[model samples]
Target: MDEAESAARRLAWGVHNAVGFVFTLFWTAGWISLALLVLLATRRRDVALRMAARCWAPGLTGGAGARLVVEGADAVDWSRPYLLVSNHQSVIDICALFQAVPVPLHFLLKQEMAKVPFVGWYARACGMLFIERDNPRAGPRLRREAAALLGAGHTLCLFPEGTRSRTGVVAPFKGGGFQSAIDAGVDVLPVAIDGAGDVLPPEGFRVRAGVITVRFGAPLATGDASGAAGRQALADAAHASVLALLRRSA
Candidate 1:
């Protein structure tokens, strides 16, 4: 088989197994599994995140293929709290992000997603914060919660573009997430994910397997920079870093 056909088959097989596992967990494990996840979340957030990943590990392996690679992660201080910003692609981006950063991550998600069945429950239990896209109070609430999370020494992962791009191109970055960093007083780590859009294109449920690389750029310097200059700097750095990674991969 050629590259494309091999990729499609691998992707389908992986996703199929993953759905089966989720169903098994729902029936066999039942509430016990959900309880265990909650207990784990309370006792050890890192382990909880790891377990979350394990629940879909088979699909993750198949979806990413052997070409999935991570680069430049050693430079991060896993013990300390830092803002992780990345380019948004497909739903697969969540799994890739979690695996790339082996730390307890709190994602800034949309309020609408909080209504999903298992996923919504998991996100809430994991202490993931969600913002109402159209709510005027959203900004203030996000800043407040972000400050609290950072104060409590928890790391956050947010997509600066706010939403997934319809096209493969990285969308323009918004400054609000960076503003949260200023409020929380932490450095922002820019992450770039290559080929996720192609792997699971946004257009449909069909999957195409290939190399999905997660690249980490050096932490964007926040230092004394704040307000517009700082936000712009962070946004520019994130876009440039991801774009550069894509170019390198190509």
Candidate 2:
């Protein structure tokens, strides 16, 4: 691209971002309150999940001028529970997955997220799972919580890299979420998300309009994984599957 075109793109991104920031703050708060209300009134998670998958999530990505295209989600049996593991890029991955996947995701979040004001409150109110990654003693409790959530047929999402990838490259998967998957005895569904970081990079809110593709891979069974060694193996397999999905989509 020429210098003129490059400068024009930057100018467009800046103008759109100014509007997007305001829209995000209000749109998110409104949907969150409504989701909480729906959960409270209906006493059912599927209702909230439907709203997110159909409306709120789509609104977030679409509002950013991102065209989201999903594939392979239809192959999975949504009736059964899953550990929806995916590659992390930026916060945009959350909205993309929530819309791409046909279910509500109870993310296996960091325990610190439990303190993020309204977000934390909504997560707690909705019974989302939070892992204390820094606390060694939290294992048994976490395992029990994972089992309960999975047993209740909740699909939990986890970014096994544990944090966003600033370089837009998939990092090595961490073992904690894999251990939880094994303990819970649910299948690990590998999801690949491409191009989200370009839309909203890890550094800050500077945005771009782009296409984000979310592709799902076959679920990896966790029944055979037994010890710590087995957990590492599962994480490795999940990571490889995600990489393969990215390659396929690319």
Which candidate number maximizes lDDT? Answer: 2
Model 2: per-residue lDDT, tens digit, 1-250? 9999999988887888888988988887788789889888999777876776787788888888899999998889998999888999988888898888776778878889899865787788777888887788997888788878887788889898989998978999977667766777789999999999998888889777899999999999998998888888999999999999999865
lDDT of each: 0.74, 0.85
Regions of model 1 farther than 4 Å from truth: 1-42, 54-58, 63-67
User: Each model's TM-score?
Assistant: 0.82, 0.91
| TM-score of decoy 2 | 0.91
Model 1 agreement with the true structure over 45-101: per-residue lDDT tens digits: 556666655545334546445256889898777888888888988777887877777
| Model 2: lDDT of residue 206 | 75
Per-residue lDDT value at 24 in model 1: 36
Q: What is the C-alpha RMSD of each candidate to the true structure, in Å?
A: 4.7, 2.3
